[model samples]
Target: MILKYIVERNNKYKTIREVLKNEFKISSRLLTKLRSNKKVLLNGFSTYFDKEINFNDIVEVYLNYEEDNSNIVPNNIPLDIIYEDESFIVINKPAGIAIHPSCLHYDNSLSNGVKYYFDKIGLKKKIRPVNRLDKDTSGLVIFAKNEYIQECLVRQMNSALFYKEYMAIVNGILEQKSGVIDVSIARKENSIIERCVSNDGENAVTLYEVLKSFDNLSLLKCILKTGRTHQIRVHCKFIGHPIIGDTLYGTKSDIISRQALHAYKVKFIHPLYNNTVEFCAPLPDDFRKIIENEI
Candidate 1:
């Protein structure tokens, strides 16, 4: 991949170093690698970092010129890919699949599946997930093809520019049509996986709007203001409308085997393309069954 930059007017940048640092936002590690690889070009020619340039000059940086070797073992597990490009891929991850390799789940994971797909397509790049969803939560998940794209997307995720929306089925009908849950959450004592609302925990915020109501359940649209571990689960419990089948925060249900939560949408600015991009994943079959009165 080649990144092209054209100097424009009203600029304070005078040197390549300034342009790279301020305009391009290149990391020191990647800059060092670029220097070693001799891939940085100015006006279609190799140039030093200190070389001077004028307005409208073109600067190009080549990336992924060599094949990358990753340790993640490839497997033939199937993937539901929604979108794919040279820089990234969006997958509709199903329930019961881990994002990456863990002690209990090593081969039959999304990472391994991505490795297999990339290998089959003859693309050599490491698997890098921009965000994660719980094992039981199904939704859209983004993965970058290279280190530069991964770092750029991660920076956006840490900022206010990235957005994630979820759809969930809660246990009870909410009194208020919509509301915000502003609370602090901390891991429960002596438990590695449980989280609860506490004054001594990190700040968490969630916005929710009731979409539809059923006999004993309510479908809700949830938007996360801050990403926390099991945030939606804990916040829904805090609001007295825990998600259905959430064994950790709420009681189990027969309608769904796992928590009835889905990451429905994601929106972000393209780090390299300079355009806004959004993706949506349709509700899984189990969620549709409950909403359509099939369960």
Candidate 2:
């Protein structure tokens, strides 16, 4: 992706380096790569970085370059892509698919599938997923197409610019229909994959509202203020309302094959255009069935 910058009256008489660093907020690391790759253009031609420019000076930084992604074995696993742009791709991932390739997942991971899609489209950029969801959690996942874009989006995490919303089905009806859970969470002792609520941990906050109740279960609309490993799961468990099928934090159940959680919405500022955008993932089959059949 080529980021264009027009030097306006207030942004005039600054070097390309200053313009990119101060005005465009380009990281030093990304600037170095752009310089090395001769990707920075001034007035439709390559120019010295330190050269001073005035009003209307057009500066463009090209980031849609190719890279070697052979480390991940591309697989043709099906993907539920929601939106795609020159800067990023958003996917509505189903339950049971790992995000990144691992020793056990190998080529069956979502990254592998994304690699295949990128290759098919002739895009050789590295796979850079901006956010993560657990293997058993269905969610909206954003994958940045370039490193610059990745950095821009990643910086928005846990901030007002990025908003993550989820729908969760948990055991027992909540007494408080709407409330916030402010607690700290840390890695469980001697456990690599488990998280627990503790005083000696990172401050995690979750704002939740009870949306629906059926029998012994309640549907909750959860908004994560601080993103941590298994944050919602750990917080729900701390409040004595763990997700219905979250075996790691709660208990296994036949009502749902995986964790009864879904990242239904994601809102963020588009890095390239600075436009606030939001996307929603439709509830998957199992989640919809439970709500429809149970009610």
Candidate 3:
């Protein structure tokens, strides 16, 4: 393992070991190992543990470990692959399926599902998801089959080169036909809850238009301008209309088990072919049924 850190102005006066443990959150044992192995260096020169650091000082620590093959596993899991080529794949993920395994969820995730599919096709490298959807939200998901394609698609996402369209069902009818929700959001607790219009938060934006209106339910087409966790749900709640069935930020309803949101369309430049590619997933049966009966 190679660890790199650049000293910032806030902690310029601390010693290298102090900075590593306090600022960078490195364990003291790890620092001692790096120092003992003489793998701790400043500006390419091996530095002592007590060396005083300054602003802009670059420190590197090299650790010994075998390469990671933990992510490479073969399991025969079902996946709805919409499109696939040499460099990339697009799949329609279903609700109740997580995108990746984390501490809370260790198996039965979309990442594992992708790995299983690749193994079925005899591909070795792990597929990397470009964007993520919440576990309960279903929609089109894109994955890069190789590192080169992964970097390209990641750059596109950071530059907002890709277009994403989502469909949502809110609790009430909007007074306006079309509008934008510009709010800042931040996490409130350790839970998945978030606060909108927060003073100390990052900017989040969502553009929406009403597609149809029922007595108390509204079908909405939403385009995300900035991708923030729980942006759509939080913003909808901020505007006095929360996503129907969103247990986290809205009044619970019987329309759906989870938040009524779906990533319907995605458009981007293909990584391997270098041409524009677009994919879409039709609304899930449950969503359509809710609309048909409510609206």
Candidate 4:
């Protein structure tokens, strides 16, 4: 893929490196590549990183390197593709499926399935997930086609430019119709699998609106201001309304076996397209049935 940049008249950058690093937000490692052997064009001619760029200078960065996918074994696991384009793909991942390969799970992950799909379609780009969901949580997961796009999306994620919305069924009704939960979360001292609200942890924020209420359950629309491990579940527990079926932070449910949390929607500005895009995954059968029969 090629990333094009045009120097504006009022820009303060004096060198190509400054423009690449500050304007285009290219990493130092990639800058080294540009300085050594990678292709960089200035005004339609091959140029060096130290070249002086003037007003209206046109710069193009060519990244055509092949990625190594030897670690991720391709498998024929079925995938539900929600959205796809030249730069990225969004999949409606099902519950109980791990997003990436781990020690316990080798070949049955969503990455394996994506590798298989890419190979079947003769695509050569490596599978790089910009965002991941828990193994037991179902919802839309985004994957970038190449490293540059992945880096761009990661910057956006760090700046909280991405908007992710979730649907969760909690154990009880909330007194307030809508509110924000601002707290810090950290890993437990002796437990690697558990997280708790703590002052020494990273700041986590969640905004929720009660969508529907029942005698013993409430459906909520949750927006994540900051993404943290078990942020939603821990915050719900901190507020005394843990999600249904979340045994780690809340009580188990007879209706479901895993946490009743689903990443239903995501909105972001496409780095390549420069347009706002949104994708939504329809509620899975288990989640829908719970709301239909119980709530």
Candidate 5:
């Protein structure tokens, strides 16, 4: 992707570097990279940052680059594409598959699939998952097409404008219809993946509203004020109503094979458009069945 900047009259930018750093918000590392690769174009010709830019000067920064993604072996898995653009790609991930490859999920991971898709389309950009959900959790996931888009979206994380909402089912109905869980969460000692409520941990906040209730279960619409690892599951456990079938943080259940949590929705500013965009995934069959009392 080429970031085009037209120098306006009475612009504060004095040089190509200034336009890139100040106007485009280009990080120092990326600027250095562009400089080294001669990726900056001044009026359609490769130019150095030291060049003086005058009014009506067009500066274009090239962001499309082929990368080495050999670590992740590509798999021919189908992607549930939600939205796609030059800046980013949105995917609705299903439960049981991870976002990236690891020792346990080496080839079947979502990144592996994305790599295959990228190869087919001849897009050599790196696979960058902008947000995260657990392996058992299903929902909307975004993969940035380039570094600039990644930086923009990542900066919005944990902020109000980068809204995220999840649908969760808990073991019991809450006495209160809606409330906030503001607390600190820390990794449990001697465990690699477990998180617990602690005063010494990082701050995490969750806002929840009861969406529906049936047969000892309460479906909740949970909005995250802060994104922490296993935040909603941990907070629900902290409140003595852990998410149903969350074997790691709560008891496993027969109603659903995996944790009854789905990343229902996400809303954020599109870095390329400078406008708000939202994406939502319908409740998966397992979640819907439970809500309909099929279990």
Candidate 6:
């Protein structure tokens, strides 16, 4: 695959290979291959390895090979089916399962499981998930089975018509029983792995209500006004109430293995049925144990 980047500043610029190696942390050999395949371009013009870059230039990249989506065979993975109709299907995704295939996880994803289920029923086309949950986070998920339903649900997501509620166990007892967290977040170090509250970050809002409190932990019902990557986790950490067991953003806890966050409820209007649909998943066993013991 080819990668392109436009120079935004007039400072000493790096080559395409150098930029990919430094910015994306990709291997040097892969960068060399991408350049050799004429997959890298600068300012809409194909150039050799020694191309000079200027500010406000538009870059285009071409891929030598296409993604082989056919090899994505179905795996007969077990799934907790919450709701299903002609238009869409909802699943209570278990923890420690990735939603889609990525660098870290190639197969054994929730998508693969969904595909396998559809294939078992003799459905050819694949279903597309309307939203995503982190690999370690578990709860309700919706998938559109066709393009018409996909477009409708995507519209609802863009307009915030879909309602999602999450449950999280944080480190400290929040003094405010209910409050709004309005913080702007942006990528840190140009990495998709980390984000931070920044002046130029995108606007994000979250409403949270404390469900229960303990000496050291508090369970919160979190609602997102604007969905952003790591929004809930980042906001909680910003308020000095980081989610328990979130190793990336806060201190890890022995009481919980992964981040103490779960999508508990989701409500949306079904495109084909033209009726409101709602689904909920109970807290995972580990999370329930923490509540039973701690709070």
Q: Which pairs of residues collide in candidate 1?
A: none
lDDT per residue (tens digit) for residues 85-198 in model 2: 888999999999999998865788999999999999999988999999999999899999999889889889847689999999999989999999999999999999998999
Off by over 4 Å in 3: 1-69, 189-195
Q: After superposition, how far is residue 270 of candidate 4 from its true place, in Å?
A: 0.9
Greater-TM-score candidate between 4 and 5: 5
**TM-score of candidate 6 on Cα atoms, chains taken together:** 0.75
Residue 178, candidate 1: C-alpha displacement in angstroms: 0.2
Distance from true position, residue 275, model 6, in Å? 1.8
Every candidate's CA RMSD: 1.7, 1.5, 9.6, 2.0, 1.2, 13.0
How many residue pairs clash in all the candidates, one count each? 0, 1, 0, 0, 0, 0
Which candidate number would show the highest lDDT if scored against the true structure?
Answer: 5
Worst 10 residues of 2 by lDDT: 5-14
In the range 197-269, model 4's lDDT, one tens digit per residue, is 9999999999999988876789999999999999999999999999999999988888999999999999889
Q: TM-scores for all candidates?
A: 0.94, 0.96, 0.74, 0.93, 0.97, 0.75
**How much is the lDDT of residue 115 in candidate 6?**
77
List, residue by residue over 1-295, the lDDT tens digit for candidate 1.
8888788886577888777777778899888888888888999998898887688899888886665647788999888899988889999999999998977666788999999999999888778898999989999999998778888888888788899999999988899999999999999999999999999999999999999999789999999998999999999999899999999889889889999999999999988788999999999999999999997
lDDT of candidates 1 onward, in order: 0.89, 0.90, 0.79, 0.89, 0.91, 0.79
Summarize candidate 5's per-residue lDDT along 1-295 as a digit string, tens digits: 8899998898888899988888888899888888887889998999989789999999999987667777778899999999999998999999999998989768988999999999899888788999999999999999998889988899898467799999999998799999999999999999999999999999999999999988989999999999999999999999999999999988879888999899999999998888999999999999999999887
CA shift at 93, candidate 5, in angstroms?
0.6
Q: In terms of lDDT, which candidate is stronger, 1 or 5?
A: 5
lDDT of 6 by residue, 200-289 (tens): 999999999999997688999999888889999999999999999899899878887899999999888876556888899989898998
Clashing pairs in 3: none
Clashes of 5: 0
How well does candidate 3 score on lDDT at residue 203?
Answer: 85
Candidate 5 accuracy as TM-score: 0.97
User: Candidate 3: TM-score?
Assistant: 0.74
38, model 1: CA deviation in Å? 2.7
